[model samples]
Target: MNITILYFARIKEVVNYSSEQVSLPDEVETIIALKSWLSNRGETWQKLFSGSGVVRAAINHELVDDMATFDEGDEVAFFPPVTGG
Candidate 1:
Protein backbone atom coordinates (compact mmCIF):
# COMPACT_ATOMS: atom_id res chain seq x y z
CA MET A 1 0.00 0.00 0.00
CA ASN A 2 1.03 3.59 -0.55
CA ILE A 3 1.05 5.68 2.62
CA THR A 4 2.21 9.12 3.62
CA ILE A 5 4.30 9.18 6.80
CA LEU A 6 4.72 12.46 8.60
CA TYR A 7 7.56 12.88 11.06
CA PHE A 8 7.67 15.22 14.01
CA ALA A 9 10.18 16.63 16.51
CA ARG A 10 13.31 14.53 16.93
CA ILE A 11 12.16 11.98 14.40
CA LYS A 12 11.98 14.69 11.74
CA GLU A 13 15.56 15.60 12.46
CA VAL A 14 16.72 12.03 12.07
CA VAL A 15 14.74 11.37 8.91
CA ASN A 16 15.66 14.82 7.62
CA TYR A 17 12.15 15.65 6.46
CA SER A 18 8.67 16.31 7.75
CA SER A 19 6.95 13.76 5.58
CA GLU A 20 7.20 11.40 2.64
CA GLN A 21 5.31 8.78 0.71
CA VAL A 22 6.35 5.18 1.02
CA SER A 23 5.32 2.03 -0.76
CA LEU A 24 5.00 -0.85 1.66
CA PRO A 25 5.90 -4.37 0.77
CA ASP A 26 3.17 -6.99 0.76
CA GLU A 27 4.17 -8.32 4.18
CA VAL A 28 3.44 -5.11 6.03
CA GLU A 29 -0.08 -5.11 7.44
CA THR A 30 -0.30 -2.77 10.44
CA ILE A 31 1.16 0.45 11.76
CA ILE A 32 3.59 -1.41 14.00
CA ALA A 33 4.71 -3.56 11.11
CA LEU A 34 5.17 -0.47 8.99
CA LYS A 35 7.43 1.03 11.64
CA SER A 36 9.53 -2.12 11.74
CA TRP A 37 9.78 -2.12 7.98
CA LEU A 38 10.83 1.50 7.95
CA SER A 39 13.48 0.84 10.54
CA ASN A 40 14.98 -1.77 8.27
CA ARG A 41 15.52 0.71 5.45
CA GLY A 42 18.76 2.23 6.72
CA GLU A 43 20.73 3.52 9.66
CA THR A 44 18.83 6.75 10.07
CA TRP A 45 15.51 5.00 10.14
CA GLN A 46 16.76 2.45 12.67
CA LYS A 47 17.94 5.01 15.19
CA LEU A 48 14.75 7.02 15.33
CA PHE A 49 12.48 4.01 15.28
CA SER A 50 14.61 1.65 17.30
CA GLY A 51 13.62 -0.07 20.54
CA SER A 52 10.30 0.87 22.21
CA GLY A 53 10.71 4.59 22.07
CA VAL A 54 7.54 6.61 22.32
CA VAL A 55 6.00 7.33 18.93
CA ARG A 56 2.51 8.32 18.01
CA ALA A 57 0.63 7.51 14.82
CA ALA A 58 -2.36 8.99 13.09
CA ILE A 59 -4.27 7.58 10.18
CA ASN A 60 -5.79 10.13 7.83
CA HIS A 61 -5.62 12.85 10.47
CA GLU A 62 -7.30 10.72 13.14
CA LEU A 63 -5.04 9.40 15.84
CA VAL A 64 -4.88 5.64 16.05
CA ASP A 65 -3.16 2.87 17.92
CA ASP A 66 -0.13 1.14 16.50
CA MET A 67 -2.27 -1.81 15.50
CA ALA A 68 -4.27 0.18 12.97
CA THR A 69 -4.43 -1.21 9.46
CA PHE A 70 -3.60 0.91 6.45
CA ASP A 71 -4.47 0.87 2.77
CA GLU A 72 -3.56 2.73 -0.36
CA GLY A 73 -3.65 6.52 -0.15
CA ASP A 74 -3.81 6.42 3.63
CA GLU A 75 -1.94 9.10 5.51
CA VAL A 76 -0.03 7.58 8.42
CA ALA A 77 2.00 9.87 10.58
CA PHE A 78 4.76 9.04 13.08
CA PHE A 79 5.39 11.49 15.85
CA PRO A 80 6.51 11.62 19.42
CA PRO A 81 3.91 11.60 22.16
CA VAL A 82 2.77 15.09 23.12
CA THR A 83 2.54 16.57 26.57
CA GLY A 84 0.73 19.67 27.79
CA GLY A 85 0.19 21.16 31.19
Candidate 2:
Protein backbone atom coordinates (compact mmCIF):
# COMPACT_ATOMS: atom_id res chain seq x y z
CA MET A 1 0.00 0.00 0.00
CA ASN A 2 1.07 3.56 -0.60
CA ILE A 3 0.76 6.48 1.81
CA THR A 4 1.92 10.00 2.41
CA ILE A 5 3.71 10.78 5.64
CA LEU A 6 3.99 14.30 6.95
CA TYR A 7 6.39 15.45 9.63
CA PHE A 8 5.80 18.44 11.84
CA ALA A 9 7.51 20.57 14.48
CA ARG A 10 10.48 18.90 16.11
CA ILE A 11 9.89 15.75 14.12
CA LYS A 12 10.39 17.67 10.90
CA GLU A 13 13.59 19.17 12.19
CA VAL A 14 14.94 15.91 13.46
CA VAL A 15 14.15 13.84 10.39
CA ASN A 16 15.20 16.63 8.01
CA TYR A 17 12.15 15.86 5.96
CA SER A 18 8.78 17.48 5.72
CA SER A 19 6.89 14.80 3.83
CA GLU A 20 7.38 11.62 1.88
CA GLN A 21 5.44 9.05 -0.11
CA VAL A 22 6.15 5.52 0.96
CA SER A 23 5.01 2.12 -0.22
CA LEU A 24 4.59 -0.36 2.60
CA PRO A 25 4.98 -4.07 2.88
CA ASP A 26 1.95 -6.17 3.70
CA GLU A 27 2.99 -6.65 7.30
CA VAL A 28 2.99 -2.90 7.83
CA GLU A 29 -0.74 -2.42 8.11
CA THR A 30 -1.08 -0.48 11.34
CA ILE A 31 0.36 2.67 12.79
CA ILE A 32 2.39 0.75 15.31
CA ALA A 33 3.72 -1.61 12.68
CA LEU A 34 4.60 1.27 10.44
CA LYS A 35 6.54 2.92 13.25
CA SER A 36 8.46 -0.25 14.02
CA TRP A 37 9.29 -0.65 10.36
CA LEU A 38 10.56 2.88 10.07
CA SER A 39 12.53 2.51 13.24
CA ASN A 40 14.45 -0.28 11.57
CA ARG A 41 15.84 2.10 8.99
CA GLY A 42 18.87 3.09 11.07
CA GLU A 43 20.03 4.74 14.26
CA THR A 44 18.60 8.13 13.34
CA TRP A 45 15.19 6.72 12.56
CA GLN A 46 15.28 4.25 15.39
CA LYS A 47 15.84 7.01 17.88
CA LEU A 48 13.04 9.08 16.37
CA PHE A 49 10.35 6.43 16.18
CA SER A 50 11.31 4.02 18.88
CA GLY A 51 12.09 4.40 22.59
CA SER A 52 9.68 5.55 25.32
CA GLY A 53 8.86 8.89 23.79
CA VAL A 54 6.84 8.03 20.71
CA VAL A 55 5.90 11.01 18.64
CA ARG A 56 2.19 11.71 18.31
CA ALA A 57 0.33 10.79 15.14
CA ALA A 58 -2.61 11.94 13.07
CA ILE A 59 -4.33 10.06 10.30
CA ASN A 60 -5.91 12.27 7.67
CA HIS A 61 -5.68 15.33 9.84
CA GLU A 62 -7.39 13.70 12.82
CA LEU A 63 -5.31 12.78 15.87
CA VAL A 64 -5.19 9.10 16.64
CA ASP A 65 -3.44 6.81 19.04
CA ASP A 66 -1.40 3.73 18.20
CA MET A 67 -4.59 1.70 17.79
CA ALA A 68 -5.43 3.52 14.57
CA THR A 69 -5.15 1.63 11.31
CA PHE A 70 -4.30 2.94 7.87
CA ASP A 71 -4.85 1.93 4.24
CA GLU A 72 -3.76 2.83 0.75
CA GLY A 73 -3.46 6.51 -0.07
CA ASP A 74 -3.80 7.47 3.58
CA GLU A 75 -2.14 10.62 4.86
CA VAL A 76 -0.33 10.14 8.14
CA ALA A 77 1.38 12.82 10.15
CA PHE A 78 3.86 12.61 13.04
CA PHE A 79 4.71 15.37 15.41
CA PRO A 80 6.06 16.09 18.84
CA PRO A 81 3.88 17.55 21.56
CA VAL A 82 2.46 20.98 20.90
CA THR A 83 1.79 23.67 23.47
CA GLY A 84 0.52 27.19 23.12
CA GLY A 85 -0.81 29.88 25.38
List TM-scores for all candidates, in order.
0.85, 0.92
Q: What is each predicted model's overall lDDT from 0 to 1?
A: 0.83, 0.89
Write model 2 residue lDDT over 1-85, tens digit each, in one string: 9999999987898889999999999889788898898888888889988756659999999999987999899999999887778
Which regions of candidate 1 fall more than 4 Å away from where they truly are? none
Clashing pairs in model 1, backbone N/Cα/C closer than 3 A: none
lDDT of 2 at 65: 92
Enumerate clash totals for all models, in the order shown.
0, 0
The window of 10 residues in a row where model 1 has the poorest summed lDDT is: 44-53
- Residue 20, model 2: Cα distance from true site in angstroms: 0.2
